[model samples]
Target: LLTPAVPTLTGLMLTGCYKFKAMKMDVIGVYTNKMSTDAYRGAGRPEATYLIERMVDIVANELKMDPVQVRRLNSPKPSEFPFATACGLTYDSGNYEAALTKALRIARWNDLLDRRARARQEGKLFGVGVSPYVEICALGPSKAMSAGGWEWGCVRVEFSGKATVITGSTPHGQGQETSFAQIAADRLGMPIEDVVVLHGDTNVAHYGRDTYGSRATVLGGTAIVMCIDKILAKTRTLAAHMLDVKPDDLTFEGGRFSAKGKSVGWGDLAPAAYVAKNIPPRFEPGLEASSFFEPENFTFPFGTHIAAVEIDRETGEARIVKYVAVDDCGPQINPLLVEGQVQGGIAHSIGQVLFERTVYDEQGQLVTGELMDYALPRAHDIPPYEIGSTVTPSPSNPMGIKGVGEAGTIGATPTIANAVMDALYPLGVRHLDLPLTPEKIWRAIQSGADDRGGDRIPEADRSAPRYTAADVGDGALQVGNV
Candidate 1:
């Protein structure tokens, strides 16, 4: 709530670009009798998307408008880049409509009528929901944030032309190690195998803000690029001396410097520079450079996600049938890694919506303190994700790249929540809060109440299934009760 990361989820997207025409959000952070809420996964963005998306469905139900059409009507057009919102924020670049259209096509949204009708005949609840989300990344212009939002990088080339890169952003399973290495390799025109990226230790890694808020790649990788530019400049100078030509006349490619048909390979030039036997005057003996890059503005990465789910009315258990996501994080350096991020982030959001919840007793004692008390979603809980991307390079950055680490998490939560609400539409259920447990769903279904005001449940509302030890049986559905 207060002073948490991303104090406002996405005010620019909520007030500026969302097609709602009229919208207002009032956030009040209050000290709770329970555990203090803080950032997790997508942080505040997921919660905001969930509530806004749920409101969209609720309004759609009142107006009988197609949810997809409603979204399409309200979103900003592709030409609306640099769109300013009612809140004090600006969207850098996005094609929100394109992403939504891509997700819908991938999800086969237009063909859902027959599917819904067929499910109804089978006495089942099948619903589809879409969420278009925008995230502000790159940790930004620095002025907009309280923390020092800048990245540092250093690139060093040994006598053997082997490259080592040190970045400020440390990788904690987000593939920063590999991605930063790839950037160095590509920039140096060296084999990917020869490039090594180092981070996580203060002695080794540059002075960095560390990893969080999807800044590792967008900001950290850019810092690497900046440092490599310095390395390349030094290389060109030494190569000019070795090739016996002016540095301006030399054109380097494939890790070789050529001028006037005279060529010098990286291996030859690196050793010559370090040896300093025949090098440019006043030049350093080794090839090394550092860069501290400060972005002028934050990069905005936006996307759309669609979730199709099925609910078993008999038990109020829901299962995701299909999931499609179209994310645009600007020119992906590695598509394979981006795909992994999208899938993994979706899993994180699904866990938050369907299974993850923290509990506390009335006296403020932690109730769900252990892993056994918390219900994290398993691999089987997440359906296969159909992932797609459209690159719209950020004009503010040199690499035109944005962050995708949190995009999947930001877009998937509301999409799944919306789908679940849609699944229970026939039962007069408008919304149910997070960790949509079966008991809560069952209670909402049976009582026809929109019990979504808060996460606090009465003691009578237990977390376990309503079967006692005596009801345990081998063949039955546990005494035929749920």
Candidate 2:
């Protein structure tokens, strides 16, 4: 909002190129003086989201409103579909209230609040937090990419009912193999097992670049849709040739190109009739198609997450008691895959809020770079989570899907952090940093004396470092050296 001169880091970050377009709006940005950049896992979106949900708890404390009620009052209404926010991004579709309410029900929000109240009366600490998130993904078509220097995909499907999809998109473990195959199977009317998806090799694939920004489902899937259409078109032609019928007379369904109202299956006419007597005089017997799709706008997927925590005031340990997420990704292609994505994202979020961080020492050398030092949450640390979704078909795509990949992470971090903060609010604390360490929480409790009057500030709380660094003096670290 405050149109300061662009920072150099903006030029360095690929996402920063889109920041200029954002500045035309009429609001003030908090981090204007600092250089901005985008990292993997959509750091900017997640960070700001964490900040906002944290602030919601702050407001709830001040107004004495139930945190859930406060959030409901401030949240975007469901009627606000395709709504343009002050930030200039257009949200395609969402029902924010429904998602939030459903998540609360699944988490038993009221029951937890009662428990927390009882715990507080018994001089224990308990809290619950909810984070509703909206993220833009599935980057639009070629024109949208050209404007932001974003990449689009090129995909091809070959003849002989065998598909070789060459996608410009690459997967670093987002399950492109499973989900993309599902899309191809449904699109081509082929059994899910029959379709083959190819990606990641720049030599073989065409018109794509590195994958990030949660664009794979939107952009990459569009490319696949395009390729499938061409393959279907050619298959229709081949069907006409083999059935001695016009291309228009042949219809595709359930992996079979059939003459409508006839029992003959398209699979029954093999490469023989397709290549020999029954085929049209000039048309080829084989089938194939390829294309580049450019969408006009980005798809926005939204969701809500709720977390319940039990805190030990003595040790300053916060344990998750319950978790629930209600998401709407706009017509899910695979329900099980969507559930997995949500669960994985939530785990990452919980890790960030409670245990995970990257750090460096005064000399700016990498420390805690190894997994032994880097804390990732294990299964034992996580409580069971209940997940549910609502289907709102996207108007933008023919397939009606919006990406669900990052929803849980974007929603869970703040939810867990807020719950922890709510549990400690009675101890007279307001703000804290990520990875809410036991030492940090214990110190905060001890340093906080009975409040006499006005708020206190010591420039900043400097004792709680962002993260710990390894003491690797002389450019080396040693363990139990035998």
Candidate 3:
């Protein structure tokens, strides 16, 4: 929405940063009579990353080179921190090799080499694939965004030491409230139950962008910390006066202020601040602070995802035997939350490449609008992810956190696609597009209907594609219109 054209839709993420000589990306935005296209789960980065990752495997097969070696040779190293790619963007800091190495270990790449040899001898389809991907997140450098990209957060402490945080990023179900509370409680040295996070009411809260582009924790959480800083500064002055010591001499821990040999609990100190009794000179009467924090640069969250799968040559069915993901979204505040995000994103990505496809017919209508026609992956369709991580903190943010919400989705699409291609490579099949249905694989094996482009299925009802009232102008849906 910031620009007339969706610039990043073509080439934004690490596609431009790969350092491959004489690399060119050609992108075209087309206008169709069907429904307008917009962001999917991972948005532009996933599509662009998937394309290049798939091409890397294709080039490896053509050159008789190992895919892992090919990627390792091309990926930038730790020495190249803040390196700019041919695509006209700079990477702040990352260790692509470390993440890839961890992913390989989790994926058991060494064992896969032996498995491939034995599977070939036994006439079985077995393969391993990897996609090392980086996504530009925290959608910042507000100037580049051309509008609103900052977050607003405010913190207020009651007289009883209870705290309330209001963040601009309203999260529906991302567990943002719980994470934000954790940060506040740790910073204030208070019990977690004493701190509460609030959002969803813009009228009562400050103004900023809502939760999209995975900006909640990195942007909104940081904003809350900044606001807490203001409160702490005011409280420290009050705390010092109550302890009868200099502000610098007072130290805080376990919700108590200690100076030399004297200490005061938050329960006693908090109410004293508002009471204006023995308060520090020029100190405020109540604790309330607000901060609108704009991230200096966008966070680049990178990771490697590996997939192992075996295909049934007889019926052209694909089964994911094992899946491994090694992601580094910087210092994780909660490991379970990070793992859950990776798992959910992997499921979404795998679904897109295997079962889900938005199809339009010759009449410019959506054929898969209903669940009966649409083929989303069910519980049985997706495999469990074995997740691991290597912490390579970002230097851009104070918390050194990079966004992980979209990392799994960014890495999984190509990993699964490559695994399928690896399984079919012995049969001379190299490249294929998404929604790798059994019919396409069987055709590619038997008669070489090499999968190209997206779903090409015909409309189920063979009816006219989306002919809305605007198109009819005169609003006439007669018997023949069907």
Best by TM-score: 3
Model 2 misplaced regions, further than 4 Å: 1-38, 141-160, 244-249, 260-278, 281-285, 449-482
Candidate 2, residue 405: lDDT: 72
Q: Write the per-residue lDDT of candidate 3 for residues 1-482, one digit (tens) a residue.
A: 42313446446663622676444655565655666665766777787788889888767655545676678778888998887766667787888888777776666666766676678678787767778988888876688776878999999888888899999889876788888999999998898899988898977685878887878899998999999889888888888877778989988888788889998877887788788877776777888888988887888888888898898887887888889998889999888888988898998887878788888888878899999989878889788779999888888778889888878888898889888877776655656778887777777766433434432322331122111223323221121121
- Model 1 lDDT vs. the true structure? 0.77
| Clash totals, every prediction | 1, 3, 2
Model 3 misplaced stretches (Cα beyond 4 Å): 1-10, 14-17, 21-24, 448-482
lDDT of candidates 1 onward, in order: 0.77, 0.65, 0.77
Rank by lDDT, highest first. Answer: 3, 1, 2
**Residue clash pairs of candidate 2:** 141-294, 141-295, 189-255
C-alpha RMSD by candidate, in order? 9.5, 11.4, 12.8
Q: Over the stretch 175-222, how does candidate 1's per-residue lDDT look in tens digits?
A: 988888899888888998998888888888748888877888988888
Tens digit per residue, CA lDDT, model 2, 1-482: 11232222122121210112323322234653333433535445566567667777676656545555556656556576676655555666767767766776666555666676677778787777777777766755555453542444443343354455666778777887778888887876667776677787767775675566667776778778877776667657666766677888876777787775663343554454445556655765545455665667777677778888887768877899888888888877778888988898888887888888677777766587899988888889888988988677777777777887777887788889988877766666677788887776776666654443223333233222111112111111121120
The superposed Cα distance between candidate 1 and the true structure at residue 306, in angstroms, equals 0.8
Estimate TM-scores for all models: 0.89, 0.80, 0.90
Q: Quote the positional error of residue 290 for candidate 3 in Å.
A: 0.6
